[model samples]
Target: MSGVLVIAEHRQGELREATLEALGAALELAPQTGRQVVTAVLADDPQALAGPLMGRTHGLRLMAHPDLTAFNPEMYLPVLEDAIAAAEPGLILMPHSSQGMDLAPALAGRLGLPLVTDCIGLTYQDGALTAQRQVYGGKVSETLVLKPASMYVCTLQGGAFEAPETSAVDTAGEEITLTELSPAHARRFVEYVAGALEDVDIAAADILVSVGRGIGGPENVPLAEELADALGATVSCSRPVADVGWLPKSRQVGTSGKTVRPKVYLALGISGAFQHQAGMKNSGTIIAVNKDPRAPIFAVAHYGLVADLFEVLPKLKDKLAG
Candidate 1:
């Protein structure tokens, strides 16, 4: 294996945090699997996006073209194929985001390499890579092993890896730019259709009181609201709460919804499924209140109270109010 190649992702000219997180994963694996880390930044002008990543990788390949303003399959596909052929990296890591979802599978299929998506854990042992991902509503975990080949491609789950800390100190890393842009394409880029603005932006909330199926009924949701009001926190929910129409989809948190990193996340009557945990697991302090002590939410919580939330809510709310 030559090295690890990280395909960086960006949006609207700004580098996405997922890029740094992918780099972090690549950096960790480089020692175990590769001798170097090469990050390929595909953009119109990679200068701005490549700045923070200067000392972060063994090499930065700035793949540039005018049509690269927005993500286009036709524009990105050929260039990435060429880069892979040139780099011959043992491992290829990218974000499991919208762009990555589109790119990774197609990249692997075209090149006949092993591929995995939305991986939460990755390990290299005995010259093979093992990927861990969620299954069956996050209740079951699936471990997939990829046998060694020329290389392997993987898309990482959001919030799974911490973004790497960066500095301006010089390293032995090299910077290289490529201008071999795909000239002709049948499809052209179009304007983005944005979703309607939500009344509340839960992603920006520092404190979130999130509910789930265990909340029982929609009528009982006010208990959570009251607690949120008393604590000056925002109300969020797991997927079931939103699916049952108890809350708007905007307030939902999980893989199929939004990812949040609040200062405090209070899970009330929530089971703490893997999908739900993936969204808010990185909160500063996690406190779970559930009747079932074995609820999966407790596994990631910093503080837990195994009791009925119906009994806990009013008391906790009043205590905060007092």
Candidate 2:
């Protein structure tokens, strides 16, 4: 194996942030394993995606095809196979997004390579691959050791690794041409349907004030929102809050919801279930308030207050106002 191959993901003619996060993981592992890093970007117009990715990888492979306007397993698999053959990578990684989820398992099965999904941490030692992932709803972690193969495939979790800086390395990635390609066809590219308009993008927020069932009921959601307004933070909620129609599903955070890495995550009246923790545990600072001292949220919080959020939130809001 000459290097690690990172499959760059794009949609609607633009690169995804998760691709950068996957690249960052590849770069981190390259030095330790003494292997180079290569990135493959497949697009209808591969040139348009090169600007942001230049000088970052040991090599760049661009596969262009008209049918690649959007990601489909049938169209991408052939080009990906060619890229892997050319790169001869020991490991292949992509972000665990919708596309990755759709493509990785089939690709690994076709190539007879072991596969891991939603891996948060990775180690390549003596050519053996070990992956770390949260299990039992993030209450416990499990490590997987795969049987040896020529190459390994994995879809990594987003928000687990930092995206690489634009000017981190000087090795300008030279683009490789994919020619005379005949792709397989089973699924066709379809129009992307945008979800309901979200009022707040909690994933991009600098700070988040989130509530849960402990907030009492839908009426008290405004209290959390008021605190968020005072702190200039966005209001988010646990799955239960959204399930009960207290908040929109877009504002919910958990395994089934958006992953966020805010600068500060203030969990108010939230018991901090493992599922909820999966979404915001990566926040820079975690301050949790719950009447239950044994709330699981405190395990990941930098600061914990074992008091009634109703009383504390009002006083804290006043403190901030003053």
Candidate 3:
């Protein structure tokens, strides 16, 4: 039971993508750290939650309770405490999302364990685990090594690691556990309200035609729209474009905006700064269009076009439309 334990995050009857990414990060560090990877899925019927993680992790610990249907910190804390006692995990990994942000700190404080959040990468060396995070608005990266603590808790940043694929044959048997919990006193469970329906959520868009400062001005934003329409893709932009009010903040993609993992990300006029890349680097197919051949964006682009976006935009639109 002295292995790594990952607290799986799920919502709306489905596991979040961040959970799989956290699993990937944990599996990557397991070999060097000499810890087996175990996942903890807590729900009213934990068995129902085991499908996605089957064969993707080294082990599974399922905690089931009727009160655990929704995410309530009060109910979750007791279950986690019991799991920790039973599993004796060397390290605990959680998603750096709403749920993990709320649960990790409190759990760490209560357990008197070291905790690191929003870690973009994890490395194990010299018998120590190091976590990497962005600093100064993603201008620089800082590494942290927590020592003297027998165990540590970390929250992995979303979209930082690739999602692991699931298999059918190599599923690890799950261990069923239970925890007793009183009703939530601080906050009671209420109905879940969905966010307002927007014209498009760039994060959910499969294909994104994103513009940058190179779009020149708001008047030229329509050019990106024309191309996006031709490609049946949503139009998103970088921070600078949103700063200048050429587009809504919701359309911005970067550290300061929403992260996107579109299948085809068309970066027009983007310089490929780390801030912007942090949002779309995981996109399945990245095609960067910029006049500067030396732009940093080309480094991550699967396809790079070293030409003026203005000239290429129209031709590309026509070709796609054809």
Candidate 4:
């Protein structure tokens, strides 16, 4: 039986939730393939990723390299490519992060393998794995099946799979051997530059209040900020608002921008376009305030308010303040 390989994603000694999600998908794929799931962590420090896989059911491997200290395509891709060759797994799963987007395609090109990017769901059908992916900015979903290959590469969408619980026995004294790769050509990381709008990571925020074109103009953003302040939430905006320079691109929420899964997402004066919804649909509780009752944002929203945000926001803010 061919094994399934899950790539662990981490940065600065912290494992990404998407890695666990990928593991969940790997677990499901393993039984169908009748093989054990194997997880591989590619990093400078393999020990840092031990916590997430401590209680995992499948086999784990660590691929460590000095060049992998920071994400660089030239260095990390070759190491991962070598790992895949060594493991000889049937399927390779990775998170659909910026790093994954860069590496998955390059790896696929290097190995001449079929690659499926941004998969939201996976299922086994007739001895083949079918992956579901969003098309046209989440307006439609397409299922893809790869031709028979030694190995397949796929990037799993974030929040598509829930993290599984780790058992005490799973974390006990189990350690996988670490493999080192010596690449003829390596990319070196020199310096890191932070984005000017670094505070715009809505995914890390507990509360997010996002605005759309319905807010009318840039001047009206203060009103939205007021409501956000009252609710103790960070302010975000849709693509249009950000494109028009009303807000920075970092604050944009859509398929072209950031995908955030905040605890509470408040959509103010925003018409929920499919692109925008894709970013925040995974949020815990979505509350949309739009004057148009026909706005598509209400479809996925847990709570909907059909009224002008200008009027609704002030009342809600005052009530909260009181």
Which candidate's TM-score is highest? 1
Query: RMSDs, each prediction?
Result: 3.4, 4.2, 5.0, 4.6
Per-residue lDDT of 1-322 in model 2, one digit per residue for the tens? 4578988899888898888899889988888668888888887888798777766666777777676768888778888897888778999999988889988998998888889998999988776889999765455779998776668999998777778887767654555555545656566656887657898798999999999888989889889889899989999999999999999999988777888899999998888776688788989999999898877789889999999989998998999989
Q: What TM-score does structure 4 among the candidates reach? A: 0.77
Stretches of candidate 3 exceeding 4 Å from the true structure: 125-127, 163-179, 183-185, 198-208, 212-234, 238-279, 282-299, 302-322
Error of 1 at 132 (Å): 3.3
Better of 2 and 4 by lDDT: 2
Q: What is the TM-score of each predicted model, taking all chains together?
A: 0.83, 0.78, 0.72, 0.77
**Tens-digit lDDT track for model 1 on 114-160?**
99999988888767889999776555789998877768999998778
Question: What shift in Å separates residue 136 of candidate 1 from its native position after superposition?
Answer: 3.8
Poorly placed runs, candidate 4 (over 4 Å): 168-186, 195-209, 214-216, 219-234, 248-264, 269-285, 290-296, 305-322
Q: Report the C-alpha displacement of residue 95, candidate 4, in angstroms.
A: 0.2
lDDT tens per residue, model 4, 29-137: 7777877777777777777777778766467777666666777777666667766777688888888887789878988888888889888888765556678987754
1 or 2, which is superior by TM-score?
1
List, residue by residue over 1-322, the lDDT tens digit for candidate 3: 1568899888777877778888888787777667688899988887887888887788888878878788988888877888898778878999887799889998998899889988988876665668899766454679998674568899887678876777622547565656568644567679887544556789988899999989999999998998888778899999899888898888988766888999999999988766688788889999999898878788789999999988998898788868
Please give the CA lDDT of all the candidate structures: 0.84, 0.84, 0.83, 0.79
Clashing pairs in 4: 54-171
Clashing pairs in 1: none
Looking at model 2, which ten-residue stretch has the lowest summed lDDT? 172-181
So what's the TM-score on candidate 1? Answer: 0.83
